[model samples]
Target: MADFNYAFISLVLLLPLALLIFLYLIVRPRSVNIPLKNRHVFITGGSSGIGLALAHQAASEGARVSILARSLKKLEEAKDAVRLSTGIDVAVFAADVRDYDAISKAVDEAGPIDVLVVNQGVFVPQELAEQDMDEVKFMLDVNLLGAFHMIKAALPTMKNRVDRRPASIALMSSQAGQVGVYGYTAYSASKFGLRGLAEALQQEVIGDNIHISLIFPPDTDTPGLVEEEKRRPELTNIIAAGGGRMKAELVAKKALNGIKSGSFIIPCNFEGALLSVATAGLSPQRSFLMAFLEVVTAGIIRIVGLCFQWVWYDSIQKWHAQKKRT
Candidate 1:
């Protein structure tokens, strides 16, 4: 009986391994690929957060980045940060991704974008029972419809212009896109729709060689997160928390790397990858495996952050007490 169990486990592993190897032998990895150097890259929501971090990283890799967002002041700041960090001149375009005309105008000004990163998004936490109509509309308009608008604007250049190499289109998705969260009724709907859109677009433009990459990032820290924490209500804990926020720079790095590699679905971190697997393997109710893992990761990070906060507060308190005593 023990021998039978061992044999069963080995067969389960080896069967999949054998099938994967067979597929690999049939179609080997592509060797010739364009590096980011001197490439014209466009990013939505690039004025802050992960998009800005990516702009900085891409500039370091010798890519000319065009940062797009609604705020002109923020765009200038982003350009300065990228220039200071990488000594690469960054161009800023103030445009709302939700507006197709604005996105098209920005793309035209950028002059044939070789890489397009769709990162514009909005996060609203409302329980399904109490979900406001406006909240749902806002999330969909920004997260799903915004991505659609950008993709449509770029499709012409990506399809007809006949660039020397294939242009890559990257969409910023979330782990919530791949799996369901308790209080993410609107958010999950938009994200899931984004993933579906990217996959369908991948099929539409595969012949044109417009490489499409959908990035599924876990919680990441960004400039906007300060406002996020301040505005967070009770529902925020369930749907809006970063869940062990990774550095923005790291998320940006992964996004570009995934694009260059032609990865269809990019998981941002180890936890994201694990969650992706768990999402595929487990049933909805049995999704506690992924939930538990996220909890454990978040708990560790929170403990560390709280400890630092506590120590700093204590030191300040001690200094005050000593000054008063003296």
Candidate 2:
């Protein structure tokens, strides 16, 4: 009797599975592994910190690297350091990312780019009320509009590469980009703009066989972070307390790995992973299994995210109360 209904039962069960498989095949990003070897990898903010570390890694991996920054002296220093470490001479360009003309000239001279990393950013942590308007404008210009200028300048050449191999554009976003935190009003606004930019850019470039990666790195041990710590407000520190700091080399490695894999969202730590899953709204995902995880765990992650928000709010209230007493 059961055997008689086997075909009907199988059809019912397998149809849903088949539909899911079809969706996975179509919706998933065109999977790609962008090869860095013997390819041009152009990095903005390459003079120091995570950008320099990434430049070093790409060079060591046999990539033809070009480093760009506003300061020519720092660019020269980065070139020397990369040469000393990898024995590969990387091209250096001095161009402020804010200036589209300067960026366009640099991209034209660097030749066709196989991978473009927009890693330049600036942050001045202060409550929105107390922060100067100029500081907000500076962060918005450098962190948000600066990336726009670089992408606009580089995209035409990157799309027309003779080799026609897959290319990558990696945006260096912070955890603040994923979620707004205390005293990061202006900074978070600028960084959060990157997520929207990355998501839309992916849709525009997928036809050109280009992939976009948005990297969310927690506080990393870098010269910039050292400087940022001196001005961090007490509330900012409290809000950022638990997320651990990672070394620049590790962050660079993570960023490169994600870039090569055509990953859409690259998270650098445990908290970052949790944050990614929680904020996985409508972002392009190349990995089928990761997409499944994101879909299945959405409800659970929402609960956990709420719990985290509650804790954060509790901290804020307690800190404010303690401050008022003093």
Q: Write the per-residue lDDT of candidate 2 for residues 1-326, one digit (tens) a residue.
A: 78869988999888767756865786667668989999999999999999999999999999999999999999999999999998999999999998999999999999989999999988899999999999999999999999999999999988888888899999999999988999999999999999999988898998899999999999998888899999999878877765667999999999999999989999998989989999999998878767767877899999998998899999889988999999
- The residue pairs found clashing in candidate 2 are none
| Superposed model 1: Cα runs more than 4 Å off | 1-17, 25-34, 233-243, 280-326
Candidate No. with top lDDT? 2
Error of 2 at 201 (Å): 1.4
